[model samples]
Target chain A: MVEVGAHATAEPLVGASDWDGGALPYRVGHKKLGMWLFIMSDSLTFGALLIAYSYARISSVAWPRPFPFFPSIVFSSVMTLCLLSSSLTMVMAVSAAKKRDKKRARKWIFATMFFGAAFVILHMIEWGHLIGDGLMAFELPEEWLKIWPGASPLFGATFFGITGLHMFHVFSGLCYLGIIALFIKRFDDEDVEISGLYWHFVDLVWMFVFPLIYLLSIKPS
Target chain B: MEHQSKETKFFNMTLLLLAGGAVLVAAWDVAVSRFRGGTDDLFFVLVALLVALLFATPPILFGIRTGWFHEKFVIDDEPPATEAAAEAHAEAHGVEGESHGVSNRLFILVWIALLGLTGLEVLLGYVQLRNDLMLTILMGASIIKAALIMAYFMHLRFERMSLVLTVVPAIVVCLCLMLILFPDSFRLFHLR
Candidate 1:
């Protein structure tokens, strides 16, 4: 039996030698492992918000899905496409790093950064439209209150909370990628891959969000 | 004891075989649905073929190369092995093989697949399908997309099995939590 303390001493753990890192069993660097672990917990946070939002959706008979069929869906689809393209570029960046082509890697990194910022801008515009329709994070708009007095206020709260958190992720991911770009020469291929992992994760979460929030709620024009 | 290691190996291999079968069925199911529109006859055929292949693969490989299924070599401290021997042992088992390190080609393929799937998903949203069927398509497609991003872009494909275990368990737990609360979601709620 290999206890935690045995790992530090001469005592042998049967499987420990198979993996890398003297004290740790990590095959990847500790930093990369830490990023993955962070992503796992962050996903749960989004999951909880989505679950609560679903609860709100199922509980009410008439949730106000105020998105215009053509305009809203088109904007969102474009945003989704932008984010997805960014993921491709992120992959390109990592691939370039693997080949030790720093110039091409920097190009891909900048391209990814552009798309990330583009998604944030698009999202903020969508938020503007929603707010124009009286979608406040905390308070129900007076116009909406007049139409449905008994409506649950939880709808807007969850919508903004979930999507807002995801937008925050995009923002932070851009910053993280930018920092990686600044010190691209300092880090190994794994660091670039780790940052790419975070970028794809943000993109992945939107894969679920885009369908559930937009496609499912599309009302026939 | 050597006996215990063998038992452990068998147990782990069995678990792996089962997992491999599950991935096959899932991918096959998705393919059948997306390609064939999920006809029941095709499903049965796919299932039968997949099961046969799953069962036959391990035994065939084992017969061809005994000790191929053995766990990666590790140096226990009872009698220390030389570094050269340890490297040779690790090399022979093929356990340290990195999947993505093969080339950038795999990641490119995965990227194109993701874009194609996203396009398919968007196109299906406009099609007049049953709500349940549409939901199934969306969910299945989303799962594949997520898996690809994790395995390739995230480089989980190249990471050791322990890191895979670390991230996957959390996702499974979250999914189970969602399932537990799923029943409540179906119930009608009244606004106060």
Candidate 2:
């Protein structure tokens, strides 16, 4: 075990209110900190859209609950599984990178990409089914209107907007992982960890999206 | 050391202008809402402006870091003390070892927990509780899931307290501020 206070060259700032503890506030590289900042801002973007959607749902007298249990919910649940699995793989990739095991890290990164691509493909299929049922960005399907005559058309917009943006992120994450995997020799473990942070962030966003969008709007049997 | 490459300067300036413009527009929206007696609109618009200002901070911070603003603004970033401080603090707390090379089993455990929570959320959806009740439960569960993924999968749990403090609070506060619109939903519902 490393000795405590062995390397404490000066007196430690034990209880000072304004003590920064160190010159490096976060003890992270600039790139990692930049990614954290990006995630923070990007979260607000999603947060605004999500809050708007929830507000609309709550305010509307007749918001359409369009997703059925069999196909829509089931398919989305599977997609959730894919994302979760991908997060696990991403963690493994970072661990491998930290160990300087380039081959294992690249393999795990590819695995993560595979799951991410699968999620996107499944999401596209789900969107295809919705569109084929006459769902549009600005318009809801006739069937939904038949059930809830006063349903807001904004349903389609929020649904597609939020999920589409998430899907784009997943797709971009795949591309980002691909770049890392292809150039694993050049990048360091910290680089891998930073990318893993982005990937986990994508999964984290979906954690809210899945339940709020899919579960809340489940169709009556 | 004070000089920045042309590319870095261009990128910083562009981000500054973009975020600055968003803050301006959002602030205008808030003002219009307040003037019109639209409290609900004001809340959301106010939150939007906060988000815009939050977004603007990173670029301004970057500018300060890279000495784009002024040399006076840049703090002394001497290396030896900072590195030694970090290493000593990490060593004292035994944070260095666990921060890296976390076991795969722990990650798999977190994965299973996330899956179980997702299943629970789906089942709760099927049970048909009251709208607000169900929404609360699902969001609670989702938040737990998000925390797990962030802490374990993203290794935030292994990170320094400073980083955790810096990252978590900002997002949590922003999200909570947005929730000021929640009660306004009932107001809108009543109006309808």
C-alpha RMSD for every candidate: 10.9, 11.3
lDDT of 2 by residue, A117-171 (tens): 9999999999998999999988988878999998989999999999999999999
Q: What's the DockQ of model 2?
A: 0.27
Query: How much lDDT does candidate 2 score?
Result: 0.80
Instruction: For candidate 2, write residues B50-103 as lDDT tens digits.
Output: 666655665565555456557656566444454334443344444344235355
Candidate 1: list runs displaced more than 4 Å: A1-24, A138-151, B1-105, B128-130, B188-192
Q: How close to the true structure is residue A82 of candidate 2, measured as C-alpha lDDT?
A: 97
Docking class of 1: incorrect
- Tell me which residue pairs clash in candidate 1: none
RMSD of 1: 10.9
Among all candidates shown, the one with the greatest TM-score: 2
- Measured against the true two-chain complex, the DockQ scores of the candidates, in the order shown, are 0.21, 0.27
Each candidate's interface RMSD: 6.6, 8.5
